[model samples]
Target chain A: MNPDLLPLALGINRVILYSGYVLLAGTFTFWSLVWPQGRKDRHLLILSIAGIALTTIATVAGPMIDIWIAGMTWAEVFSPISAAALFVRLAALAAAAFFLVDIVNYPIASWRRALPLTIVVAIAATMVASSNAVGGPWEVVKLVATMGHVIATAAWLGGLVALAAVLIPRQYLAELDKVIPRFSIIAATSVVVLLVTGTLHALAIAGGFQELVTSDYGIVFFIKVAIFGAMLLMGNHGRKYANGVALRAAAAARASKEAKINHDKLTKGGPGMHSLAVAMGAELAIAFGILLTTSLLVFVAPH
Target chain B: MSRPQYSLPNLRRFLGACVVTAFLVTAVAAYYGTPEPLPASVDTTSDAAAATGGPADQAPATVTIEPEPTAAGVELPSEGPGVSEPGLLLIAAPLPDGTWDVSEQVMLAKPTTSLTLAPADISRAGSQFGFARPEATSVQVSVGEQPVVIPEARVIEQVSADIPSTTRFEISYRLDGATVTTVPSTARRGIGAIMPVTSGLDPDLPVVVMVVGETVLSLSCPELSLSERNCGTAAGDEAMILAEPLPFGAAVVAAQIDIPRL
Candidate 1:
């Protein structure tokens, strides 16, 4: 294999693995907390399964790529650095397994679900420890900041996916009424965290404004920013639509005779629901592009 | 559902708008941020080996020095901003240890340069390899009809590598018509190759680019075990390298051929 190809392939693997873990943890958290019938929802199970499958692929492929790039035998993967990576992958696997067990044994009680969620948080923490931000000066400080960034990203993106796939399609104004507004708050906080951590990372690498444009790394970084901008626009539209739905639902709930009529109309493919769905879907697509660029950014030389 | 006096929907809209505003403002601030002034010249002649504060008693490599490549003009695609000639750009960064971390990137000149080193290079140090080449301060090259100028190139951290297992050490480039191939520096290990190239002339003027380096440390052990290994020197030590005026040469089978404008 071409030596450079190994790193690029490994970068792709990371993107896939991270997406899986984030979606799994984020979707499950929202399902358990907000949705009244979340536990019984098949969509939640499917989402968890998909996340687990992707994480598993990454866990297996990541180490192999290391071995290939190093031109070392399989036995060398037990080295300290590889071991750390393996640790994160294993935690992600365990979290996925827990989700499977929870699904297999239906009605396992609410408290028991916390096990998987706890494991999910552990996965996030381990990921942060193994990232570029950590293993450097002020390790603890950087790790904490990176961890916050990772968790917030997982929650925001995963929640959007879950909302679009499960809740938006159902279009119950009452459910939309509860989930949309609450999700908006969570997303707002997550975006703030993402923006802060992302900026810090950029400043650390670029060092100055000149480096950002002069270097190849800087050029790719700008591309990421552009994709992020698109996501923000879509997210704004989605938020507005959600807000409109909530207001209409509230007004309809207060009316005695027209309550059922208004609720049926809103629940059955209303303009607000369609708009929110499209906006959320577009935002998710743009976010995926951002993630791919991030993988490339790490591999490029940051002058 | 219970309704509060204040509208929750409005609150959601306000928060969402706030996040978007924050995102846009931060991006704008960064893109248009003031750039620092560029240094007039980088001190390329400095003997990095002596300055590294390594063990003073250690002896340097004893290799016969061949004639360096002659200074000659080569036609590049253009002299536009951010343009690089299609060839091997050998960069040597001095590490904390006396040795130098010599890396080569197969650069294809494009309208917009988005350059990245072969992952094989970053993995040289294993997982801890942050891929940060802080030592590659500048590029000194002579383009046709233009004064030799060292333009700034950015390097980002890629994936990690196992120091001992990373055997690819030499950097070589070969230009074949429209295709430019970079030989896996690892194939040569410590020994480098100097080859002559035709400088787009009728008689084919030979331009010699010499790439030679000595590995200060290499880990070789049974079964990839970290602890039980045979590394002559401490890990993370760099390979000592000397590249005379850069020139294209014969490439190895494993070398990658990158077509420009693709």
Candidate 2:
């Protein structure tokens, strides 16, 4: 908050932000291995861990270098090294965004599993983006909303995959019973959160409606909205699939019981009963694409 | 069949490390980088109240100006070598309206040259300033410990602030006659209201007024915004003359003109 170290503080802030992203990625990376039957490739785990460390280092470098550049009592302190550090960190944030799509095991049917990762990526991008405008503290708000949007999209898509591909393919009236209702509540809540937080982050970054459509930043935003709208449509249909409401009553009743058993098994870390992994994977892949664009958005000037 | 769940030692450890690191960094910045307040020795311009009862009517600041024999008799061309030798460094010209300074204070240890300007003929005010000079007058002298590499040598209209350039009444170093150069003292602005520093000098000695050009004047309200200006009690302003011509042997070495209050 001190003005004297304003440059350094900004630099540090960037570092702190990157570290948060790595930690986020690390949690999921760890969880992927932590679960039973998950792949235990030591090499992959090392790569993930190393990515996190690089991200963390990039975040820290932002501030320390800024401080060094702005600091020192004598006038002879300026040099090329500090400028190089800042450029490197910015590039790191962009790289971290790309790795979000590249890193990790995208589990098939559990929308719940994808939710946290999505939110983390969103928040990280938001932090990197907002760093351009509202620097000098108070930028945390944008990060929060961005993270929320991320979590929502992940959960929405992941859940859709769970319903259509996993639960539906089982073709057992039994599996639909548990998957539909549970996913219903999750999708509903996630959608609401997504709408609210997305609106807030959008308004803050775009600096209001005029800029939203006029600047290059605005065009990217418009594209993002189009993708979001399409996803929403996919999700509404997804909800119906999860609830079995459109199915014959007999099938719905039988599906209800199957869903309950499936829930119990999933909670206990047992193998999945539904065959919805492909659907969820498709949803995730689409979401990942959106996320990369979002990463690019973070770097674009709001004008 | 399972042990009771408990606290996350890892989470606690992370938080603890963050706190410790934050404290350490803050402490380091505070210790080494924090700047102390500068003392008031040099920056008294902000405190006008302490500088004066306004401009002093009490004569001018005095200073002891001893011209080395090498510089003596160089004021008027009629009194020294013909208008063709070195600056003679013998002209003991004192600066006008200098900040309170000391020769031993490590500030005035500089090589010097002098020039004079006035109506070339007494019948005019600010007109007819040309005079004849032998081609070799006013040679450059290296003054400081730093070796000065002369990049260009010529009498040009543009005057450099860093290099010593002066225009005042200068007599020939070898001949006993005066000759004014095409160089006119081009000093701009008036005496800054800031109390010029004065040095100790014997009033009995002559004070030489070495001007940059003919006459210099600074009016308060450079943009004409202020109603008031720093001038002497002469109706609208305070009249500040650099040197009152002294009797033949006596010279007025220096004077501190009160700047007009803008």
Structural similarity to truth (TM-score) of each candidate = 0.57, 0.32
lDDT of 2 at A42: 43
True contacts kept of each: 0.00, 0.00
Per-prediction CA RMSD (Å): 17.7, 24.3
Best by TM-score: 1
Please compute DockQ, using alpha carbons, for every candidate against the native two-chain complex.
0.03, 0.01
For this target, which candidate reaches the highest DockQ against the unseen true structure? 1
True-vs-predicted CA distance for residue B134, candidate 2, Å: 64
The DockQ-based CAPRI class assigned to model 2 is incorrect
Model 1 Cα displacement at B257 (Å)?
A: 21
Error of 1 at A156 (Å): 0.9
Tens-place lDDT digits, model 1, residues A102-139: 44355433776575566567668656644555433455
